[model samples]
Target: MSTLNFRRNTNNFVSGSYDKLIIIWQVYSNNQWYCQQKLNGHSNWILCLLLNNNDDLIISESEDNTIKFWIKQNQWVCQQTITYHTGIVFSLSLNDQQSKVISFSDDYQILLDRKWNVIQKIKVDKYGLRLCFINDNQFIFQSFCQEQMQIYEMDNKTKQYRRMNEITIKCGSNFDHYSFPQQYVKSKCLLVNKNGKSVNLMRKKENGDFIIEKSIEFDDQRIYGQLGQDREYLITWDNKSKEIQIRKCKER
Candidate 1:
């Protein structure tokens, strides 16, 4: 596989092979990686890719102004192709439980079901950069310049969607768009960059509002700058000392 843009899901890794091909890799329990299947349909660069919870469905967005879905069985095959986006698809999210998937491009939200059928198309002030399912009925969205994260409600039975409200995720600071895998804890969520230097923990209230639970700044030398496994430890790697320093809490 060509080392281009690569994105990871829970069980598999989606990577672009060269500029035109995308392949799905499965990591086994013994820590070995194997190319389970290859998807060969794009004519341009693959911008983003992801796998659903079941690890059987692959969603890829490309600069070709298209989104393609593939199934992982004996062979990787194109299950459906969505060519309605006017611009390049930037991001996508899938809620397997609700059997709904949503994609975002320049200024639209393309909602599709499990069968890869277009259900609705709605316009927002800015494109929805990333999405997180709060539950079966609701999800949260963050944008490029938007200070508040938007909450969207979906009908349980009909899967109809509405922009219910907005909540302040970052008050004084500008929103970060590059980092994903936003961690959800209770009603609160943790947002961090890939480098892990800065971390923000925010909480959502019952009224669909958000507040900053904590904002932490770490040393520049710390290789791993965020909270550790159980949120009970902070790890920092020191190159000069050649040691890993861990700041952990005392056991209760």
Candidate 2:
């Protein structure tokens, strides 16, 4: 419930709290992140969200079992909904083209078209908890209570996605997890939060394998990381003072 976001390629950010609210933050002429607007809609906790560059649109899925689409014109407001879960919609992910999406809830992994309509659904033994599109045709998925990490690819012939590969991930514990922006995931390689006190940088190999490249340590309590839009910086929570901190990534 302590999740937040920093937009890329622009001086804006977003955050969702346990209170079921979304706040948009922007850096105005003063070069400071300031609250620009607050969006209210979900009746329960906001579990995950996504926003693109212009920050004109946002998609957030909540524990209330619905995905709300928001648009910004005169104000930020919800315009559409994707609801199918009986419990918490743990994670949501979209491809770069915004033409395909996936959501995980309970024991199901559902795929949707651009309009938020369910196109496909799969039942799984382990709950899908976190997701990020590795590319337009490939995605990375993690389980809620297991160390398994998997990559899925869309089969052009069938127009369906299937598991391509898998690996056992190293989490702080079986429960430590978080989601990062997919745009940054493709560029910076990977976003990592090491039990909240440190963040590790990971880069993908030419073969599509990932390796830890660097580590950024923090004295604050365990916090997650979100890559800056440029992929040259990262933002994390300063748990001690309830503030946000930014760190620059050294050039490769």
Candidate 3:
């Protein structure tokens, strides 16, 4: 599986794969998972997947240079396909209010409204592996192989997003992959980012500044993990260790 998103309330999850298919899985009370549906639309590998707050909408990015929106009605159906990006769509992030979505590609960063209409497209100098919204009006984009992550904020006058600042991050190697997308936990005000060979944990302050809380380095660039929902632990697996490791969060 290339990307996966879980609906916390329903115990159902969706996964996208390298085979160019999206599978929805239903979890039973006995802890067994069964295939609920298989969605086919992308012509290439599915890169990223995001489920909306209500779990009724799914946005998927693919190597086919397209973003597909699947709506749940009778069954999951493709309601829209966005082909604005000329290159592979790398990442997709929905805002906190679910009023907008931001997508990063090899060519441009596109912003869309709730109705999935393109509102703005900004040409990026370097294609980032991950981009995510910190809040409703602010977001952070990590440039490929760059040591700094750019922050964009919405302008009060124009209502357009512009690059406001940057936060220094660790990029130990140029070697990169598709997994370990940037994730922000709102309840804890934390951001987990994987850049090159290190997973950097940052704390987002109320003033919109990010402070690097921790940086975990691995021998290999292939590091994959995620933060626990309770914000108490982080579980990760690396190619070098070849074992699943769990790290507890230290309170400051």
Candidate 4:
């Protein structure tokens, strides 16, 4: 269940909670949204919401540090009390592939593979918030600490989670991390730094090093921009006037 809205596309059963009342809605064949049921269960704000991979199960994490798991046929009931965190649960990620779950909290610790029916927990240095699966066996985690970004790589080995390595992305004013799937290209990641009148395109090497590939600096600050789909067809937005400009990369 979501904070303000929760719905499933399989049965089209929608539910939302406000204050102490949880309202469930239904979508009919007429292509309209309507309320169908209301559930009054939680007494706090709903922070994180999740629907299981099959869409048959639902799990929610609240500011109260309680995780409620509910099956679709029944009302929202507490399935498990994951008292893994000392403080509030900020983020939750599940590794359904390995039958494991990961939860990051404001308490500056990482709970790894908590759903694997094993009593094991992996903790890292910084407080991890967002996570991305690099592969079926590995995961990329990011932590925000004191204006710096810390990146960690978590690998599942022998059914146990381990921290392989960690890196820190340099602190820059307009530096942004953009992820491009492997389908576009192998080992492809972009970091664009907007330097007032110039835009720099940096690519991540296979060795995990950032290298500047191209630099586009225009005399007029308004004539440069960072635009592209994956890492290809980067078009510098026309920042000066109505004139249009395009730049395409020709594979060598």
Model 1 ranges with Cα > 4 A deviation:
1-12, 26-36, 96-98, 110-114, 155-159, 171-199, 204-209, 216-252
- Candidate 2 local lDDT, 34-107, one digit each (tens): 87888899998887878754667788888788889898779888898877666678776777777667787764
Clash number for every model? 0, 3, 0, 1
Q: Model 2, clash count?
A: 3
lDDT tens per residue, model 3, 169-233: 99898877768888899988999998999899999888778999999988888887888767799
- Over 23-112, each residue of candidate 1 has an lDDT whose tens digit, in order, gives 767789999988876678987777667666566777887778898988866887998888888886766666637376677776466555
> Candidate 1 at residue 244, lDDT?
66
Q: Candidates sorted by lDDT, descending order?
A: 3, 2, 1, 4
Residue 53 lDDT (model 2): 49
How far residue 244's Cα lies from its native spot in candidate 2, in Å, is 7.5
> What TM-score should be assigned to candidate 2?
0.77
Poorly placed runs, candidate 4 (over 4 Å): 1-24, 38-41, 74-76, 96-98, 113-118, 145-158, 167-252
- Which 10 consecutive residues of model 2 have the lowest summed lDDT? 175-184
User: What lDDT does the true structure give each of the candidates?
Assistant: 0.60, 0.67, 0.87, 0.50
Stretches off by above 4 angstroms in model 2 are 7-12, 25-37, 177-184, 188-200, 212-222, 235-252
Q: List TM-scores for all candidates, in order.
A: 0.67, 0.77, 0.95, 0.56
